[model samples]
Target: MGGQENVDYSIVICTYNPDENVLKRCLQAVRQLNVANISTEVILVDNNSKVRVQDLPYIKEYTAGIPGLKQLFVVKQGLLYARLAAIAEAKGAQIVFFDDDNEPESEYLQELHRLNKQFPNVAAWGPGNVEVDFVDGVDDNIREVALQLFQHRTATTVGFAAIKDWQPCYPYGTGLCIKTDLCREYLQQVNQGRLTLTGRNGNKLSSGEDTQMIMLCISKGYAAGISPALRLTHIITAKRANRPYMNRLLYGTRSCYETCMVQVFPERKQMLESKLISGAKFSRQTLKKFLKTKWNRSPQKTFDLIQFIAAHASDYMALDKPLPGFVNKVLTSLKIV
Candidate 1:
């Protein structure tokens, strides 16, 4: 039902409003894959992009001559929806998810194939070394935060453990490889509206769809882990690495903490509820730190701290309004709105 259909690996790249040059670089890297003798396929899922990927002048130039198979699908939705679309079309045993900006190493497929064989029980595998390259060159001010912002991982290891204990070791959306059947199972839940997290949708930066999928696999007794052998480079545009963009990303991350906790770790619902109930006090303490960061002119850290305060304070204060209420207040006070 899977690889028996002739596709052994399905490389899925999901993109939305991607820069033409960046997309070309990503495709160029894909065209350079050392696929050996294994049958492979590349599926590009354009997530409701303003510009159709196929219409791009340089798209065919980069995607041309890429071994086994190539496909393009327009999901016209968020990241998860686009991924689900790719899953529906993928005929390979393993479905590797790549962002439009991700450039995989030449041996990426070979390494992933080896890991799949070595750890058959591990349902999902992540790249161990996810290096970041800024298109406009690295800025000294944002250099440190940029690495964290882009989810760069330098740790090298090959092990499958509990998803919770793995920390940042678990697979992220970039260069994430999962079984086709598992992806198909997830697609069914998403289609049935059982899954609530929609990943990032246009202006909305909320995420954790990848974690949700990994958790689902774990719940079904399949493990998730990282392999040092798998590697990829995440190309960051200058516009995306700035304070404003990072602020939105951090805010999205903090706002979705409760959702991720509730959906991925349902057993900890009581703990999360208790924490949120006392969030007013936590918010006060966090506000003090936020003020200190503001004074220190650390926008990245300030937003990171404040978003947590905003998420929990809204819950504790029993605000009928959205989390933005807290955000608006803080932003007004900081004069950043």
Candidate 2:
């Protein structure tokens, strides 16, 4: 299923229930990537999917032609667990992460390989994404926000740029490539209850795991940046454009910000709280929108925001002390569908 113990790159693609046609196209794109003699392996970790891999037409039909392709089913639900499993099994110095929906360019692998060679001791780097809105009737305003949500851009520099200050720490998980050693280090912190957000377990969208990892790496003297050499097409279908998912996305984004701040700014505990309190409250219109569908408040929205604030508040209280059960529980909790 994979190459020798030492490979130039191990491309990890983690997924839940994926669109079959898009999956085929992505696999085909992977099959066509120009590794150019760089030892590589493509590991597809099915994260507790309901669909059997054996029954998936794309797995049987499309990936037969994809060399270095390995399929591993992860019964664990969260993306963090799937990724932990992937890191344990990965045999590459650099592991490039790709989402199932991303169609990386022909030179994606080669460029990542080049970047790894270029930036020694670099933790991770990723190319910006081109968003392909796959839904009709998406208004310009919605499209604008969706573009920012899906696309990861670097303003300071695009190619091998060192992160001198704390800006957007890393790219989104799509087309994000990291060194295997750093991935292991990041997971160790996750085990220790430091970084939160940035994982998907079924319906729970507590995210920023990617950002947290890169931020942690930077704190430990690792170099990370946005690379222009690599590129991928990130597909956002109509389903994600709906109201419920949009709310989840917004909540997850803020939740991730809170957790990441907790990890990186443990000293500014009171200061963080002040900022949160001083921040603008939810508008009347926004609250009405949350209440329109139901007589009461939206439980999902309420819980998500509560968790977000609690995460930061808990960390603020903890300071250097160990975080208790409650903070980590909500961070990793699965939504009871």
Per-residue accuracy of model 1 over 1-337 as CA lDDT, tens digit each: 2333877899888888789888888999998999887788888887777778778788778888976545556656788778877788888998899899999999999988888887889999988888999888766787777787687888756767765523566777789998888888887877787667778876667566877788778877888988888889999988888876776666665566556546555676666556554435564666677678858886556765656664774343332224334445775564433
What TM-score would every model get versus the actual structure?
0.89, 0.77
lDDT at position 130, candidate 1: 88
As a whole number from 0 to 100, the lDDT of residue 310 in candidate 2 is: 46
> What is the Cα-based TM-score of model 2?
0.77
Best by TM-score: 1
Query: Per-residue alpha-carbon lDDT of model 2 for 201-268, expressed as tens digits?
Result: 66766556776766666777777767766777776677675555655565565545645756765665
Give candidate 1 regions above 4 Å deviation: 1-4, 164-166, 277-279, 300-304, 310-328, 331-337
Pairs in clash, predicted candidate 1 = none
Query: After superposition, which runs of candidate 2 have C-alpha atoms over 4 Å from their true positions?
Result: 1-4, 135-137, 152-169, 196-198, 268-270, 273-337
